[model samples]
Target: MTASPSAARGLAARLADGPVICAEGYLFELERRGYLQAGAFVPEVVLEHPERVTALHEEFVHAGSDVVEAFTYYTHREKLRVIGAVDLLEPLNREALALASRVAADTGTLLAGNICNTNVYDPADPASADRARAMFTEQVGWAAEAGVDYVIGETFGFLGEALVALEVVREAGLPAVITMNLHEAPRTREGTELPEAMRRLADAGASVVGLNCGRGPATMLPLLAELVDAVPVPVAALPVPYRTDAAHPHFQALVDEAYPGLPSGRPFPTALDPFTCNRYEIADFARAATDAGAHYLGLCCGAAPHHVRAMAEALGRTPPASRYSEDMSRHVYFGSDPTLARLNLEYGRTL
Candidate 1:
C-alpha cells in the first residue's frame, strides 16, 4: 500500500497536475471517536492514543487524501496553556507530526504540518499578536525539523493572525498554505474582504491561499470564486460538509428548529448530525470547486472517509477506498441483476 520514493512529489508540484486533497478537521473527527474532548478540542490523543491518530491518517490516505496533515490544529501553546498542559505542547505537536509523516511516507502522500487560529490574537492588542507569533514560530520550527512537505495555516479568522502564521512559516523556509475562516460575514474579523485578504497572503509569499471551515459548499464557493480572481496562486477551498445556506451561512449560526431548546443553542462542534451533507453533495462540491479554479479541495469538519472517497472520485480519481464504493446494481430490490427475485423487485415500489 506504499508508493515508491521515486513517485513522491512536493505539494506545489502535485498541484500543477490537478486537484490536491488535504483532509482536515481532525479535532472534530477524533473527538467523535471518544479519544479527545470536544470542549477543549485539544489533540491530547496524539500522545494519549498514538495508534488511533495513525489509523485516522491511514484512513484518510486510503480514502484519497493527497496530503496527510498533522493533527496539530489546536495544539498550540496558547490552547495548551488554557488546558493547564502547556508542558505537553512540544511533545504533542512532535508526536502528531511524526504520526502524519509515517502515514504520508507509507501512502506516498504529501506530509503537512499544521497551525491554526490562536484564540488570543486581537488586532487592537500588540501583545496578543506577539504571543501568537511565538506560538507559530515554535510549531513551524518543529514541523520543519520533522521535514514536512509544507505547513498549513488554516481556520484563521483574523488577517493579522494569518499574516503572523505566514511570516513564521516563511521564516522556516517552508511553503505556506494559508487559509482563513469566514464567520457569517464575507470579511475577516478584522474587517478585511476575503479576496483582498487572500491577495495579501499570496503577495506575501503564501504558496496557496483561500478559505477553510466556518462555511459549507454553498457559502464557501462564492468567496472562493472571488479569491481565484484576486490571487494568481492556486486557491484552496475546504468547506465543512454541512448544508449551510445563505440564512445559515456559518454552521455555528445554524438553528436546529427540531431541537428548539438545546443547551448551547447551536449545532456546531456536536449535534450537527441533522445538517451533515451526504456523499453526493460532497461529490457535487468537488466538481464545482474544480471548475471554479480551486486546485486544492477538501472537507473541513464533519469529513469522513466516504466523503473523501467521493471527492476523489468526483475529481476522476479511483483511490484505494473506491474499491468499496456503492454498487446499487447488487442491491436486493433496486438491483439490475436478472437472478434477483422479480416479485421482490416489483414489490419494492410499494415499500
Candidate 2:
C-alpha cells in the first residue's frame, strides 16, 4: 500500500485509530551494522550511505512501525560541531528527512521529523537556551519543508529544554510529540518531578507527552503510570530494551562485575549485550505500556526488528514480518506432527 503526500494521515489521526508503533534506536542499530559511530553518535551515514539508511527504514516499516521517523537524532548543529562536521549538518538533516519521506510514502506510514537533546541546554547560562533553540528551529524548518506529518522532540533530560523543543515544533505548525529522559533521580535535571515535567510539556502544546530512553521498561512504567494520570495529553513511552532494575534504573548506570576489565568501567554503549532483553520481554513491555495508558509505544536504544515485531504482536497486530515469526513446533526435535522423525524427537531429551 502507498500513501501519497495528500493521502497521508497525521500523527493524531493515526493515534485515534489504534496504538502507534514507532521504531527508534537507529543509532544503536546502525552502529551494530557498522555504518555509524557510537561515541560520536552522529548520523553522517545519512549522507555517506543513503542505501543503508533506506534499508533500515524499510525493515522497520515491514516490522510494523506506524511511523517512519527521520534519523536526525543527533544531526543537530551542536553534535555536528562536536565532531567538526558542521559543514555536513544541513545536508545530513535534509537527506535523512528525504529518506524517511520516501519510506513513509511507500509503506503508508506517518513520517516524523525528529529533534533530540541538544546537550547544550544550561539553566545557569541563558545563552545555552538560545543555542538549543537555534538548532531546533533549523532542523524543524527542514522537516517542515520536507512536509513531515509531525515532529518529535525526545530524550530531553530537562523540562526547560523539552519546553524549548516543544516551542520550536509548535512554531513550525506541526503536531509535537515530546518525551523526556529521566536519570536515576526520577526527576528532570532542574529537579521538577517527572509527572510535573510532562504536565508542563503538555500545557505548552505537545500533542503527546511522556518518557523515553534512560530507563528500561521496568523502571519507565512506574513513571508512565504517573504521566497517564497527571497529564491530559496522550502519553508516549519508549524504553531502552534492557533489563534495568531499581538498583540500576538506567542502562548507562548498569554495571557488570562479572567483567571488571571493561574499558569504560561500564556496560552502556558497546558492552550491554548481557543486559539486552529478548523478544518476550519486549512483548511483555508493550502489553504493560498500553495498560498504563501509553498509546504511543516503541522501543529505544537497543531495539531490533524482532523486538518491533514482538511489540506489534503484543498489540494484537501482525505486521508483514510476522510471516517469519518463530514456529518452534515445526522444529526437527520439537515437532509434534506425526510425520516428524521419532528418532530425533527422542534424542532431543538425551542430547
Candidate 3:
C-alpha cells in the first residue's frame, strides 16, 4: 500500500537542496531557567510550564533552527516511573507535541518528533527490547497524530534502542532520522562498532542515520567520517558543545550518575562550566562535517541559540533575523588566539 503525501514527504526532499539546521537543547535550557528538579528532568517543566517550552522552541527557530523538535526526551513511561510520575507519560508526550507544533506553526519551522535513550535497551535482554519497541511504537503514533513533519531518534547509546526507534518510525510510515550517541572505541555502549551500526540503522530503513550527543566535535569528526563512508543516506552530526575525547566523552561525564549510589539531588545539568566550544569551534566542526558529507548539521546538549546562528552562518545560509550578527570575537575560544591554544607548551618553543 502506498503512503499518504504527508507521510511520504520525507526529510530527504526537504534537505535535498542543502543541509537542514536543527537543534533541541530544551532540557539544558529549562534547567538553566530553574524549571526542572533533580530527578524530575524535562517532563516536569512540560507539565508545569508548557509556555516555557513553547518559548524555547520559538527562540531556536529565531536563531535559525529549521526544525523545532518536540521535547520528548526523558518523558517516557519508564523514566517517569523513576520519579513516581508514571501517570504523566501520555500527558507529557502529548503536551510536548502540542507545544512544538504550536511553535512550528508560529515560526514556519518544521516540527520533528524527538525520541531518545531508554536506558534499558539491552540486546541481551528480550523483555527489555520488547518494552522499548512498545515505547517507540506509542510515541511514534502520538507524533504522527500530532502532525510532526518528521521524527528523530537521537542520543541513543545502544544500537538496539536506536534500531528499534528507526524501525518503529519506518513502520509508522513517517520520515525518520536515527542518530546514535557513540563515544570512544568507534563503538556504541553495547560494543557495536559504529560503521556497522550506522549501516544497520540505514538498512533498517532510517531516512537519515548518523551520530549525535555523546561527545563534542573534537571527537566526533573521525566517527562522522567513518559514517559518511558507510551509509548511503544523509548523515547527521549533532555533538554536544563541551570538550570531549574518546577517553572522557559524553556530557554525563561531567555529571555524577544516580546509579551506583545515593541520588545527588543535583540539578539535571551539573558541570556545565564553560569549558566548552565557542561558536567558532562549533562552526569549524559544522564545516568539516559538511565537507565530510553530513547533511543535517545541528547541536545537542549545552547548545544555545548563538551556536545555532553560527552554524547557519557558517553554512552560508542566512540566519534568522531575530539575531543580527554572530560576533565571534566575543568568545576568546572562537577568537584568533595562539596563546590560548598554548603552542609553546606543546612544542616547548615560544618561536
Candidate 4:
C-alpha cells in the first residue's frame, strides 16, 4: 500500500513545480503598507518594528503563497557591518528564519531563506568576488542551521554572484532557487545572456532558476521564453512594478518632501497606483510564464495579494499543502569554497 520512491518524488516535484507567489521584500512591502516609513532597509527597520516582519509573512501566507521567503535578504554580516549591526547578524538571521518558519508551519506553507546580492559590485576587483562568496557561504550556513527548507537567492544582477550563491547553497545541502533581475536588453547586469545564465546556473547546481524583480512582465516575456528553452529545471517569473517615465519626477519630489531623512539619497519613484495591472493583465502574465515553461509564477514589487489570487486562479490550482523543511537537502552541495570540479563530483554522487 506504500507509494514507490519514484512516485513520492514525482508528487514532491509536482508540488514544488507549481506557482510560488511572493510577498515583496520586507522593507518595500512594509513601506507600501504604511507600516514602515520609506528610505530604510529591512534590517534597520526590523530593529525598530520587528513585528512588521512577521506581519508581512502572515499577509503573504493568507494571500495564498506556496512559499514564504525569510526576511533575511539584507541581513548579511558584511551589510550589517555597514549599518553598525555587525554583532546583530546572527540574531537577526536566526530570528528572521524562525519567524518565517513559524508562520509557514501555521499556514501550511514553505519557508525559503532569502539570500540577496552583496550590494557591492566591483568587477575590476577579485576581492569583491571572494568577499561575496564568503558572505553567501556564511548566510547559507546560518539559514541551514536555522532550519530553512530552501535558499532563495533573489535579485542578483550578476551571473558571477549567482554562481557564488548557488555554490554556497549546494554545499549547505539545500534546495536553491536563483532569480536574476533583467536589464532593458533582457540580459543580466553583467551583460551575460539569459540563456547562457540559465545553462550556467543549472550546471552550477540550482534546483529552480528564472527571472524576478525586473521591469514589468510585458518587457520580460521574451526573456522568459529564452530561459524556458535553456534549462530543464522548473522556471519562475516575478516582475516588479512598472516605471512611470512621466510621473517619476513628481513622485521623487513628493517622496523627498514626505521623507527628508531617506538614507540612499535616491528619490522615491512614484508608487504604482495599484491599477498598474488589472486582473486580466496579471492573468496574461501568469499564462505566458506557464506557457513559456515557468512552472512557478508570482509577482515581485507592485504585486499585491490580489495578484497572487488572480494568478492562482488562472493556473486553476490551489497552493500545495505540504510544508518545506530547511534541512531537507533535496538537491544541495557543501564546502567552504568548493571549486566547480568538486561541485560536479558532489552533484554526480547526489544524482
| Cα lDDT listed for each candidate | 0.89, 0.90, 0.79, 0.68
Candidate 4 local lDDT, residue 327: 29
TM-score of each: 0.97, 0.97, 0.85, 0.77
Q: After superposition, how far is residue 315 of candidate 1 from its true place, in Å?
A: 0.6
Taking the tens digit of each residue's C-alpha lDDT, what string does model 4 give over 1-351?
121122323313645656556556456666676665443364655556668778777766665677767778778877787767688887788777777777766765666788888877556678898999888887888788766677889888888888888998989988888888765465777788889988899888888898877557666665777787899877878876443232231222223345545564544433445326676687788887888878766777666666666666677755332132122333345332344357655776666
Please tell me which predicted candidate would have the highest lDDT against the true structure. Answer: 2
Worst 10 residues of 3 by lDDT: 1-10
lDDT of 3 by residue, 110-216 (tens): 78898888877888888998999888888888999898878999988888888888888888888788998865566888888888999998888888898888678
Query: Cα miss at 133, model 4 (Å)?
Result: 1.5
Poorly placed runs, candidate 4 (over 4 Å): 1-17, 243-270, 318-351
- lDDT of model 4 at position 204: 86
Can you give the lDDT of residue 304 in candidate 3?
88
Candidate 2 lDDT score relative to the true structure: 0.90
Clash totals, every prediction: 0, 0, 0, 6
Among the numbered candidates, top TM-score falls to 2
lDDT (tens digit, per residue) of candidate 1 on 1-351: 232231356887899888899898788888888998988888899999999999999999899999999898999988998899999998998888888888877777898889999999999999999999999999999999888889999999999999999999999988999999898799999899878898899999999999999899899887777789899999999999999999999999888889977777788768899999999999999999988889999989989888999999999999999999998876888877788899877776467
> Cα miss at 107, model 3 (Å)?
2.4
Candidates 2 and 4 compared: the better one by lDDT is: 2
